[model samples]
Target: MAELQTHYPDVVPDLPDLYEPLVLFYERGGEFVRDNAGFLDLTGVLFRPGTLRGHLGAPSLSTLSDTVLDAVDAEGRISYYTTADGQGPLLRRRELRDEQRDELFSRDLQWEPTDRIPGSKEEAKDAGLVELDEIAAANLIAVILSNTSR
Candidate 1:
């Protein structure tokens, strides 16, 4: 656990005190753009079972399902590992994040909790809000189209 504290400082914030597993969902090799499905994957980021309590910080595939090809949800959230009988969401809420507006997937593709839910602009500031801009949407379409051509 101390090794994690020494490494991947960026992931330290995610190492909660809880004994349960911690998943750091990624955008699944996709770009950061409005309405992108990969951005919503949650299970793709699981580090490994019991890693949460050990505080072995940073995200890893070990924490998630055994397979990488598993299906991800429309929001980019990974489906629960029913095959592995992994943990499922304790609760569900609809919300957005800042990554939804970025041009690239980089670090911005990561998800974070926000106080506000989707469809409410007023709560954006407090929550890691995602504002849907036409430019962002168009950018996504362009990327998808360009990639398909290749």
Candidate 2:
């Protein structure tokens, strides 16, 4: 783990497309956008499962799946993940940093707590927040088949 951390630039190519895996699920090769059959797949960027966790500290696929699967309701339009509505628009306090950023993702008292639900925004933050190195969605696709051959 330490070795990968030390020599990451050499061993692992930066995956801007794979940055926000939650937004764009990992696939070796496929259409960048596919808003059909339930999933709004913005896939195309992919990394070997082992390499991802080892090199870039991405969550294990299982961990990711567990986190995302349920939150996505049947409609799939809204799926909440770790960190919801941070600090309510960053209220002005002379400086951005002084805007109480750390307490941003605090679970709202209004919402019933489920004792640390798997996909809660808190879990995503607690388990090491992944800063997404990702591509602009518009550049990729306008609704295409994920696996045209399949």
Best by lDDT: 1
Clashing pairs in 2: 16-133, 16-134, 82-121, 83-121
For residues 16-124, write the lDDT of model 1, one tens digit per residue: 4343323232334333332343343333332223434674453332323222122122343211111112121111132234333211221233224432243334443
Overall lDDT per candidate, in order of appearance: 0.32, 0.30
Q: In model 1, how large is the Cα lDDT of residue 143?
A: 42
TM-score, one value per model: 0.18, 0.18
User: What lDDT is reached at residue 91 by model 2?
Assistant: 11
Candidate 2 lDDT, tens digit per residue, 1-150? 445546896775553434555454334232445444444444423333334347565423332332222222112122222224321211110113233112121222112323232344455557443222222111111111112223
Worst lDDT 10-window in candidate 2: 136-145
After TM-score superposition, the amount by which residue 96's alpha carbon in candidate 1 deviates from its true location, in angstroms, is: 20
The TM-score between candidate 1 and the true structure equals 0.18
Superposing all C-alpha atoms, what RMSD in Å does each candidate have to the true structure? Answer: 17.7, 17.6
